[model samples]
Target: MHFSRVPVRTLDTDEKSVAQFGTEKMLESAVLLADSDLDAVVTLSEEITKATGLPCSTSTLAQVEVLKKYGVKRLSLTGPYVDGPMRGLVAFYQGLGYEVLKTSQMNERNNVVFGNTPLVRIKELIREADHPDAECIVVACTNWPAALVVQEMEAELGKPIYDSVCVTLWKALGMVGVGIPLFGWGGLLQDDPILKKMEDVLEILLTCCAASRTTLRLDFLQKNCHVDTVCAEACAAGIAQLKQILVQNDLANTDIPPPKALMDVYAVRAQMLAPLVRGDEIYGWISVHQVGKTRVWTEDEIGELREAVERVNGILRTAGWI
Candidate 1:
């Protein structure tokens, strides 16, 4: 595998500027990895993929995926960040349906100081952030050399350790279809059956829906969606419009008229959307779209979609993502 590194300026508080930096710097790579835990920077994976025609992974997304693979619901977080960014990380995890039981930070803003942090101090921060109930411990920030001590920390703490750098590499390698056995880093590098089960569930959804595309859009992560098929710009716009309509009508599903944008822009003739709800909260929705020609959704087809939702919800609950 070819490897290269391009460094950017420190993150801007403004998300637009961060996105611009990502799109500009992430070109000409077979697979892109945005090495930042900030939501603004990490959430640009989809956008970067669209622009560069390459798979993209971010530090935040990689951490989340690792947690999902482990079925980790509760997290303890530590990082070399000030209170604001630390809290942002907590919120980001909570928004994704993970319980952040505790957080510890260095309260440092200097990236140079972040990198200079001693391994002993890093271990202390991880211990301070750890909660008895937290299923996993996440050490955030790619600049810090946390990866060097993750395996040791995990052994000492007796739970999974996810350092930002390690998880990013794990996801990046998987994206490029390279399976090099990574050891002495963390448990995330190992194979797990849960990941395969999640893949199979999505595959079943596509076959049951009989639609051209199926997407799972989490409300908190509006810019990114887990899709069974790549959605073009027009299809993405249509899905956004459909989501808006679902909200406006206070409906559990989008069984209403096709969004004008779906028909006019994307030639999307038929669509079905169902909310993935766990009790009172609606975290996200599953959408199936049929393009080209309009077709009425049959009762059997709708039933099959609902059944798939139930099955997915069961899997999510088991995986601690709900």
Candidate 2:
């Protein structure tokens, strides 16, 4: 459905702008959105729809008054907001001389609230739907942020959720339906026929890896510096001069950098994986970052960071992210 997201500002300039309402400035913000393609406009439940719904603004009661004035009988009555506010929304809609079509019993404060499951709850709500007389469910209040959850709710409820945003999307997707599967909101959009297949495939790929979560990325260096390489080789050569010293310390080949570099090639990370292999075979793999966030890498934590990148890449490839 047409999901409408209102905007909230953060403390910084990078904050994303959205269509929102809270004060007179917010109400006047509509002029900015006059060219906006939003399907549903949201406002307070008690405030007159004449401002939002009818342009000049009118209350639900006043909206009915205006509709009656226009000889419009088909009132797609919705509301009660999430938790139905103080009273039952069904009663409120009935009071407006229109039939109650759908009610999500939603948590009305979805816009700013993090981690609310409008999808899961509405899925449960639609199971009890029964519509016989209304042309369409008016949906709940606009501010409820039920747009994403509406379609899946309708698909299951055997009737529409009639949300403002969802209705707008319903009108937009009239005959052609979208197939992208979203996980956070919009109920069945997360579990639609096609989305389930992809998520299932993605899950399987992830489960097939046993890599450490420490990877790194480095730049595409042209080659090892000649001066640095000469220095490194000379240092390794000096290890022989102190062979007696190493043996005295119970450390063999300890004076050389060659062995460490080989064991940790380019300081790359190695990960031993126990994937769900077809047989009992396991794989030990090494990976190179090739590019990274920083210009030069740090000496410490390099191995672990490199390993994490390997792990992530393997998972992505297995999941077809490559």
Candidate 3:
């Protein structure tokens, strides 16, 4: 798919002194553009999400994608916005379970100044925002020329640096199942298999570990149920399975004989469950199985499964899901 830029004039020349894009107007522009030229629309501005009362940085779809991909619960944020909007941006991420360990804003309102800020200043701001508990650093504005310095900054800081524009492109490409190689942008790009796997695992988490049977029951009791019965039952079952695995910590047919009840429920002769864990904490669990015949899980297969689960834990910790 070809990439296109749809210029949104947020303000006229006379209105340039203040940021003037209302949420209704911005959504209207996005809807109009999606109708005319794109399969999907990813807004680059964080302000829109903030103004729209979204829990996270809804202004840009890329920010949400990045948070999901990394499972970032705690973050270090650096951006180019005024004090008020900057606080709103941090609060947005916080609402999604991300704890802002530190935040550094340039306090620059003019696009020209933000775009023209020196590379050294960018590095300094990121450094100021860095914290030991932060899982990743997010350079949070699309128009601040952050992509140009992302590679060097990530290397220097010894953590991933997610620039807004690069993340938008990454999500767009993935949406179309395109695996085009990209380099020097940041850890998110470079066509990294690990990053893609992390994204895949998070998708599984969102789909599989949705909610427990107890939660569904509560919803039904409160008359707040929105999910259909079939779907809700499925989610509850999947979550129950994951919780069972978490209590066991490790389970494999090769190591221990499968219980009759477990076998009956899954209808599987061979199965392995790996916990998504960091240190001593367990976030969730994932498993692989064979349906009919007994099969052995090889060393490589088990190792890969553990790695994927660990990756999920890392992302969840960073995104504040855990």
Candidate 4:
């Protein structure tokens, strides 16, 4: 039922609300840090930016130095570093005047590598995402098989870990935002800038609603007739359902023309009622009007359209958007 990186432990016992200590828990445990580690971290600032080909207004050098000076060398690297700038990072580190080491991909928990790096099955979340922005990028798990390969993993990934342990540490340290330094392991000590950016993109894509949802005035639905109050309310509800579908797909801010719009059809005067079913559960809908320009759309066609809109509507309801 949870969506974020914070782990969910479903309780069978009688527990009131759960306390989320994902990051804070990690930070409470003491770890040592240093100022020179920042030097080692900065050596690759340019290298990482070059490898990523993304502009970095923030200084990763200063961030790395902070982690190096204050990071705990606890045996919590998370899983082995996989699915990153694997080869390029090795070269980048060598150029940074640092020793780059690597380790075999292991599965202390024996996780099957389904699809390389970010594994995906056929018709998987990553695949059906269809849009690149829709894919969930999980960079780490508390039980990652590579927890033992901290130094080697960082050198290999060329990015902050952002794994389960990493986020936990970041979350914990964020509670006290003093300019403290981590020596070597842990993460960026605060927010992983790259991860934060990825999260921002994901949030926009997952939560956006279509800007093109033109609410139909029951009265002016076609050319100049407005629907009565009761019918108008129902239509508004159905249109809200339509909006949910567009938002889930990140297809918000739609700019399609009237002829090519999601809900741009006109309404006139022709009527009938039909059965509407959600699984065995059924509701009812009667035709309100017809388009004067186009031929009257049949009951079957309208029924199908209603079903599509309702499917998304159900999701909106589940998401608590009644």
TM-score each candidate. Answer: 0.51, 0.31, 0.50, 0.20
Q: Which stretches of candidate 3 lie over 4 Å from their true place?
A: 1-19, 27-37, 44-59, 194-322
1 versus 3: better TM-score goes to = 1
Q: What tens-digit string does per-residue lDDT give for candidate 2 at 161-232?
A: 345544333223322444333333333222333223333332333233221121112111222112112101
Q: What lDDT, from 0 to 1, does candidate 1 have?
A: 0.65
lDDT of 4 by residue, 53-92 (tens): 3222222233233334444221111223333322343444
Top candidate (TM-score): 1
Arranged by TM-score, best first: 1, 3, 2, 4
Q: Report the error of model 2 at residue 58, Å.
A: 9.9
What lDDT score is found at residue 112 in candidate 1? 72
Residue-pair clashes, model 1: 0
Model 1, residue pairs in steric clash: none
Q: On residues 84-201, what C-alpha lDDT tens digit does candidate 1 reach at each position? A: 7787888889999999999998887666788889999999999999999999889988889998888677757777888899888887777766563344566566433443454455
Give me the overall lDDT of model 4.
0.30
lDDT per model vs. reference: 0.65, 0.35, 0.57, 0.30
lDDT of 2 at 208: 34
Highest lDDT among the candidates is held by which one? 1
Clashes of each: 0, 22, 10, 30
lDDT of 4 at 65: 36
